[model samples]
Target: MISAKFRVQLPEGIWVADTSRAFPDATFRLLSGLRIGEKAVELGEVIADDPQAIIDRPQSSIDGWELLEATDERALTKYETTDIELYEFVESSALTVEFPVVVRDGWYEFDLTGTRDDLERFGDALDEAGQPYELQSIVGTTDPESLLTDRQRELLDAALQAGYFEVPRDCTLAELAETLGVDKSTASTVLRTGEAKLVAWFLTGPKQN
Candidate 1:
């Protein structure tokens, strides 16, 4: 199977037109979900760089979504919708994908492993449904290892070469930062975020379809 990554505009993406308009800085990270009879409930995290007063009114700030929990960095919420094509796309395509899917700014970015025919089929389905989408990109495969950003990849490569991940730890964070020409904190964040994404990549599953 081939792996492809692309961003498409989906009208079925309810979050963008709904809550994001209120707070442009907040991004909804879908974790998992369940069905309550006819309605559905999604449990996910909301990261807001400019949190503003949204957290204070979590109970009512979001429209369709119901805030079930909150923390300093993110908020957990539940909402109901009947968009089966979307939830199904997480697994339904001949492609294999992980969730919660990345959706924001009026688009859904999909990273999936499948064949070209599979992508065409999915796109055709979208056309038939009258849901217009922009195909952003297509690549040959995906994995936990392919998720790293350039800076993160550079730092990881440097760290590995210097034995930073080794038990004895050949290099310090400062040394790695210096090697990459970045500050300690910058290097730390790149490595940390990259590591976290890799961990999440490994642990990804339990789709709430």
Candidate 2:
């Protein structure tokens, strides 16, 4: 299985998008949702200073909206909407959506898990529909260690432990080589080759063969 992360700019005039843009400081989480005939019903939570004001405001694309609960900084709501294009696409593609679709800065960010083919098809469909989206990453479920040799894994672990990969690196190439008792050239070659393999596996998948 593969898990793909996506960030989609919600179309203008949608309630959630408009509200999020209006209150950029607030966070809106679409916890769960389902389609009911031509309408889509969703349950969500809003984290804001004035949740009641948001609940009272009028919005487009919504047939019904109700605030189920509210506190000083949070609100729970149930709403039914007519803007179902994105919802329909997700349902028809047979991909499983992770909950709590985050809404901020007029964008909906979420993860969808499925086979590679299904995810590719879904992305294509979104493009055909002219929806604006960004594919952040596609991560395979397989363990990354399975793709590396024992030596590669050992070097990587040592590098990590020595803070070689840190923002302000604590260990230099010479130090790393000394720790492994290897010549500088051999250590550099092994580290570079291993890094390339890991990058390839992350962007695509494990090499076949």
Candidate 3:
């Protein structure tokens, strides 16, 4: 199995897109959704200074909207929408979506987990449909630690202790190499490879066996 992160451009005419674009500073998180025929019922939350703006915004695609809860900084809402292109596409594909789907700056960012073949097919479908998307990362295995070697783990731990990954790195690569008693080139290769694995692991998240 493989997990991938994708950032997709919101399709035109979708209420989520319209609202998100209208309130660029606000964050919309789709907590859950259910498709009913050509429409969909979604439960979501908005994080913004004026959470009421989302409730006040008039959108033609939204058939019904109800505010479930609200605070100064956030609001929970349930709404029915006629725009279900993305939802239908995911339903037709073999991929499984991991919510809450985040919307900000006119983009929908979400994670998908599936077999390699399923992911390839979903990518092909997106291309055929002319949907703009960015594949952020892909991890082959769910067990992140399993991807690292013993030596790599040891070096990464040492680097962490030395603050090599800090904003203003406490130690230089040469310094780390010297401490590990290895040449700079070997240390560099190991660190680079190990870092890539760690990043991929972080993106995909660890799954239970």
Candidate 4:
């Protein structure tokens, strides 16, 4: 559920855009055929069941984070392999997306030209998994009035109504602050406090069991 902007620099004539498009399907196949944590590496359209196999022959790139392999695919592919411990971080790190970004005016701006599909899938997967984002507001057992200040609730509700969570997500903190008629820091603080309270209420002070 994390919202981020990124830019990637690819080598000339790599057709990486097409690769990314076909990737989801290929990845789907790789996952359904394997077990969790098993490594799968891609060389052109050919994906291997071995991580060491591909790491030994990484493709040349201008400057970008290669998709390599997502953990879910690895785990699904692991069903075909005997070694399972090799893919320990598959659940957390592999499934996670790291978009390369250029800092512009203190905000991360994404390059959506070539890898739009991948970014889309990344965002979708996160939403399905229920992760973090720029304007994430969790539903908690605690009543809104009991957990957050009146102003905090008001701003969050406004942000939600303003499509803050929609992709391409909108509403920068400064912009939202202007809309809410508050200083940027105050807006950020209120949102953070509200989120913290919601999380605390939802988790009920963490598990003792």
Candidate 5:
């Protein structure tokens, strides 16, 4: 995965309004020891990108900020309009906010680059809160089939042979479970988890494009 520091400068006007609508009375809050009014609030996410960026604020803080009140029209303009004084303040402003962005390394990564098969496998892993395997995690194991567990191997084998992964639809999960001599829930869990791990394995060890 590729990792880098990401810093965004938002005009106070834009920042306050976005935060206000996103949060309520408590919006635009500053750090405890910092002067509250001088600094602007920001919201961001570390997403997969050509040049990755990271968001560092805690989830609880994000939730708190989101609860603040809406921004009036005046506040919105502070960040929107280019005021010389505001610009100076922004430039000389002691405000410093920093976060890290990590981009996952994988096959031909671009915005929305993953194939259907890749997305299905990777998305499930993301849902499970699994940190991506470092880029090149599976350099030696080139075959997708080699990365899975026995059950996962069975599931994928069945899905392919029986066309479960097909668009028109193939054998149901229940059918696969019966054929594998496992309970439906057990088989489903294994298949899903295995799929996620398989995707994680596909990405090279963490390195940026």
Candidate 6:
């Protein structure tokens, strides 16, 4: 499979309002979102230096949206529900991909993996939906690191977000295991091996080492 990343500018909505004000720097991992009647229901979290602001700050949607629920932590997991029109647009568009979509600075950034045809279809979908997007990066061939597998990527990504690499380590090995519903040893191995492979891949960079 091939991978690509893009930046999408959604139409005016709550996300636009919130990104402009309350959490300009907040990073989002959208877990689930869809249109429910005249409004959109979004379930996601803010991953940043300060996550509490996301939960406590008041939201403003020029169009229309309602913050149904939010908590101080676990913003990604807990049902931080909201009504957002952007969610509807995203769900209906070709730009939709499997990877968790990241919203920050009022733009949607995401990585997608598929064949060339799939990517072409994605572009077509965006065009059909009238959603303009900027292609940030594209990988046409198989990534050697694709060997890491989907589960490994998810585990490593979660660990990284949980501050597993911090000096004090915000999350313990056991905590990571609990998050992934796996045993401590399994989590430890996933973190260790994932880090090693990712670092080696980065050191190798564009040219095959």
Model 2 has an lDDT value of 0.78
lDDT-better candidate, 3 vs 6: 3
Candidates' TM-scores?
0.51, 0.63, 0.66, 0.30, 0.30, 0.52
Over 1-209, each residue of candidate 6 has an lDDT whose tens digit, in order, gives 45678888655655444553456766777645455666644445566666666655555532333344445543443332354555555455433433356777767786665556667777787888787799999765436567366777889889889998789999998888898898664565556555644554454335644
Model 4, range 131-175, lDDT digits (tens) per residue? 433322222222435555687689889878877756875877788
Residue range 11-108, candidate 1, lDDT tens digits? 63454444555665667665555544544455555688644355454332233766676667666656665544455654455444444456675566
lDDT of 6 at 6: 82
Q: At residue 108, give the lDDT of candidate 1.
A: 64
TM-score of 4: 0.30
Residue pairs of candidate 1 with colliding backbone atoms = 3-140
Cα lDDT for residue 52, candidate 4: 39
* Regions more than 4 Å wrong, model 3: 142-209
Q: Output the lDDT of residue 139, model 6.
A: 66
| Each prediction's whole-model lDDT (CA) | 0.61, 0.78, 0.80, 0.39, 0.37, 0.61
Ranking by TM-score: 3, 2, 6, 1, 5, 4
In candidate 4, what residue range of length 10 has the lowest lDDT sum? 97-106
Q: Pick the candidate with the highest lDDT.
A: 3
Structural RMSD, model 6: 10.1
Where is the poorest 10-residue window by lDDT in model 5? 74-83
* Model 3, residue pairs in steric clash: none
Give Cα distance to truth, residue 75, candidate 1, Å.
Answer: 1.5
Number of clashing residue pairs in every model?
A: 1, 0, 0, 14, 22, 0
Global Cα lDDT for candidate 6? 0.61
Q: What TM-score does model 2 achieve against the real structure?
A: 0.63
* lDDT, residue 160, model 2: 90
lDDT of 5 by residue, 1-209 (tens): 21112222232333323343333322232211112354433322211221111112222222223322222221110111221232233223221111111112211111111234443444454345432322322223345565555866877777688877888777888887888787564565557656654555456433446
